[model samples]
Target: MNLFDLGWDDFASKSFHPFCSGDLVPARVALGHKHACELLSAHGELLAECTGRLLHETASHADLPAVGDWVAVRLRPDEPRAGPASRRRADIHAVLPRKTKFSRRAAGDDGGEQLLAANVDTVFLVTALDANYNLRRIERYLAVAWESGAQPVVVLNKSDLHPDPAAIRAAVESVAIGAPVVALSAAHDESVAALAPWLRPASTIALLGSSGVGKSTLVNRLLGEPRQPTGAVSDAVGKGRHTTTRRELLVTPSGALVIDTPGLRELQFWDVANDSLDSTFADIAALAARCRFGDCAHRSEPGCAVQAALEDGSLDADRWQSYQKLQREQAYAARKADPRLAREHGTAWRKIHRAQRMQQRLKSGE
Candidate 1:
């Protein structure tokens, strides 16, 4: 595989110079496993594991190589090939700086960021048009996608099931801000042509969505073969069982690199900054600009544009609530990431609690 086909460019070449002089070769991580990874190098596909020094020096798991990451690898010439079943193995010495990355909070209470895919040019936020259609979920995805620095395209899959796919696409477009919404049945070849613009040659796109949203099916369709296993959605719950168990990058027949991820059951934002949040909710941000106060919270304040829109029905109540919920969550995650901010927040809350208790005692004549 050509390195450029995997999204490599001058930025990657510049970042790779530090390790280029040695036996190190630039490879893109095609599949990331717990202990090892499959990389696409100039020499072709090879299995590689991170060097002990690389693992020990890393501050967090997010620093490790992920699917779609470009890394400096050293091929082990002395080690004999394991067997016909496995490719030659190498050691990944370093990961180049990612121009874009999709990430979410790690599952459990760790409060750590989990890198999903790196160096992706576009993200396909797939959602089925059936019972799984959810604007709120799409909004959440848009937040992370915006934070990732990648262009987000909403793919309304299973369009054949809907009588008016255009209507559904319009609805998605309303809340999607300026992001493009493409409605197509991945099962149909003609309909899938709508996605060709984003699947440009040499660009990397990642498919992301919940279970039963047909991400794997879309990958298969794009590949023009059943390379990825797909599952059927349950009639009762409209949810499909997990089929793609791991994140893997593949080259589509169209000459574009694509990453197919396992359907995400939970997607929590991790370290998303306020600028990205505003970009995701650009509609609200625009309305907020008309408010009388620059610092207006848009709640019960006089001349508050957001609240006025909510009252007059110009803005959606559900979307406003979703925005608020995400804002609070992002704020909390930020506080968690910064110990000083968390301490200040706790102190402020304690002061408010004390003031409330004092007022209560005075009212009761205690």
Candidate 2:
């Protein structure tokens, strides 16, 4: 098979370096486990491990290859590394610079973001139209997708379970703003073709959603086989078991590479910048541009375009509020990174509140 047929273009674009040209063999990490990885090279599939030196010098989690990382590997002659003692163990010499990385804050207090996949061209934010459909949650996923630097496509899976798929699509489009939202049932073979545009060759797409949302089912449908198992949904909760335990890189017959990740129960925000947040909330940003003041906070600020739009029915209050909530979350997350800045912002807030109280007293003639 040609290199391009196995999703090589996307991975190579990120990790290939001129300096490493000729000396190293290129391989894409198909699956990453704690001990080793499954790598797909031009020659064939191989079981690989990082050199002890590479492991010793590793500074962060990102240093270790993740699913979809294009790595520079020190080739071992036909035989697999004999054992732990062998010096010829496949070593990850280096990782090519990534074109795009999809990440979310790791769950819990670590405060570190977990890299979900690297060099992804498209992110499929899957949401189901059954009892689990929640537009607000879709908005949250869009924020993370936009932040990942990949084009986001909202996939409304399990549409057959819902009588009004259009309503669910409209709800997703409401917050999606500029994203493409498609409704289909991954359980049904024909319905899965709706994702054809993104399933083209050389493209790398990752499926992300909460567990039991049919992420695996969708993956199996696209594969045209039961490569991934579908879990049975509970009769009471309408949620299925989390069938996918690890992230895997699967090559489709169409030559597209798809990464199926275990569903994310929580997506914490580590340090998403305002640009992504702005992109996710573009509608509010566009409305805010016409605010009377250059720095209108949109909270009772005279002629505040966002507030005006909300009152005049040009914008949805729920969406506007969601934008503000996400904005505050991003701002707080940023502040958490810098102690001095956090302190400064805390003091500023107090002073601003104090000044506002005084102004209110004067306006009330107290």
Candidate 3:
């Protein structure tokens, strides 16, 4: 397959222009190994590792080439990254510009960013109908997916297990604003058809969710075979067994490119603008806009539209709480990423509270 078949285009050509040379060739990272990566090039698949320049020059792990990333590589017959060269060993020099990338805070106390998927066109947030399903989790996925510059699709898998799948879909739809919601049982062959619209030829879609959400089963269903291992959900916990251990890119028979990832137990945001949060909870944002006080906290503030909606039957109280929780979480991440932001965060909230008090006094004619 040529570069075009691998989703290469003019933008990629331009992004890789500076690195174009006789020795370098364009390749896509099909799989990322701990010390090496499997790359797909015109000459075929080759095992590659980062050059000394890339290893020392990159600022963080996010800078390295990852699965689904197009990169400039040198297929040297003699110069492998480590020891003697293999059949078609390669050295990844640099990664091309990523049109879209899904990222999250690195695991543990380390304040770092982890790139989940790069150069993806769409992100399928899969969740099972059993004990793994949660509206809050879906909202969190939507927030990161929105910030990733990719179209978000909520896949409600294991529909066969739920008696009221339609009702659950309706409930999920209420929170997954501006994103398509698909309900299907990945075990059934016919269910693959529901995911066909996003599986267009050459387009890239990444499947992401927590363990036991049927991600591997969904991948196998799309492949028309059991290439990926599948496991049954534990009856005691109603959760799925984790089968896929790593992230890899696969091409379906229909020609669509897919990146399947291991289940994420915790998903925290990296440094991101509030636009993503606003997009995820647009209903709350729209209500907050109509509040009498611009600085109104959704608590007992007068004419607080968000509070009003919570009091009436207009908005679900859980969703409102979810929005606030995400807001706080993202804020904390921002502070950790930038110490200046951390210093200003307290002052910023104090200013808002002072303004709120003034607004309240004016509204009360004091």
**lDDT by candidate, in order shown:** 0.87, 0.78, 0.85
TM-score of each: 0.92, 0.85, 0.87
Could you tell me which residue pairs clash in candidate 2?
14-97, 15-96
Q: Which of the two, 2 or 3, has more TM-score?
A: 3
lDDT of 1: 0.87
lDDT of 2 by residue, 1-366 (tens): 456766776347545765365667788888875467877777666677887776778776765888888888877775655665443336677767777787776766646657888878899999888887887788788888888888999999888899999987887787897789999988788887789989889788999889888887888777777776557532222243342233388888777889988777877666688889889988888888888999887899898888778888988888877777888878877786556888999999999999999999999999
Model 2: C-alpha RMSD to truth?
A: 5.5
Q: What clash pairs does model 3 have? A: none
Query: Candidate 2: which stretches are off by over 4 Å?
Result: 10-14, 18-22, 80-89, 232-247, 336-366
In model 1, which regions exceed 4 Å deviation? 82-85, 232-247, 354-366
**Candidate with better TM-score, 1 vs 2:** 1
Question: What lDDT is obtained when candidate 2 is compared to the true structure?
Answer: 0.78
Give lDDT tens digits, candidate 3, residues 1-366.
788778887778899889876678999988775468888778777778899888888888888887889989987765434533444788988888898898889898875888888899989999999976899999999999999999999999999999999999999999999999999999899987999889988898899999788888899888887766556432222243332233378878988888887668899988766999999999999999999999998789889998889889699989988998999998888887787877798789999999999999999999
Give the candidate order by descending TM-score.
1, 3, 2
lDDT of 2 at 133: 81
